[model samples]
Target: MCSCQQHSTATSVATLAPNGAISFRVEDMTCGHCAGTIKQAIEGRIPGALVTADPASKLVNVQGSADFAAIKSAVVAAGYTPSAEPIG
Candidate 1:
């Protein structure tokens, strides 16, 4: 029960993106390392793009002209499952 409580607490600590940024929920990211990998993967596919993630919130914010499909693909390539909904 303690572990379950801890997990719930951690999940509640995630941060959401500020207004005007494109955001999505990534299901498989469990830590900072996963976030870093996701960021790298996005930047690799779309150079000069900005990517940020809050693992607790399971939210990923990407700043760029890349379409939703490209962003989704990048997240998938980075080993995380990304949803298509934009968190405005």
Candidate 2:
């Protein structure tokens, strides 16, 4: 007997967009290391920040109340270009 039920094996990316949450498109983020670096950079600057980075998409999402400028600065400090896509 074979199971015919369709199931999703793909892992969904959990992005929390609470108040003050921000997402930035990072250029030069080519691998997991880059993602980890970016995550660390932001978390270092803003304690209690939850950062999720997808290297494949070059998108880093931060969930915290940190200042926007500080987040951008952290990206720059990590040697990556931060491109903010305005959310309407």
Candidate 3:
């Protein structure tokens, strides 16, 4: 099982690109269903947005016109906590 319980809160942990692509880490999301829900939530809110969520890596990337705040909210709305991957 993915032990991503270390981070249970949503924090400002995303990178917004010039093209509006976002890449962030969601610590509490640890399964295909969790990823699917997040993907659906984001896509539903932002039409034409491409969202890729990987449970194994705990990373979620969004390619479309979505701000950092919006993506974070979507993850939270899906019942997961998003955060930045801890740096070494």
> Who wins the lDDT comparison?
3
TM-score of 1: 0.71
As for model 2, its CA RMSD to the true structure in angstroms is 11.6
- For model 3, how does the per-residue alpha-carbon lDDT over 8-57 read when each residue is reduced to its tens digit? 55454565545556778886677787788889988888877899999798
- Estimate the TM-score of every prediction: 0.71, 0.71, 0.72
Q: Whole-model lDDT, candidate 3? A: 0.71
Residue 67 CA displacement from its true place in model 2, Å: 1.7
lDDT, residue 65, candidate 1: 37
Q: Over 4 Å off in model 2, which ranges?
A: 1-20, 84-86
Model 1 scores worst on lDDT over the 10 consecutive residues at 1-10
| C-alpha root-mean-square deviation, each candidate | 6.5, 11.6, 5.0
Using TM-score as the measure, which candidate wins? 3
Q: Rank the candidates by TM-score, best first.
A: 3, 1, 2
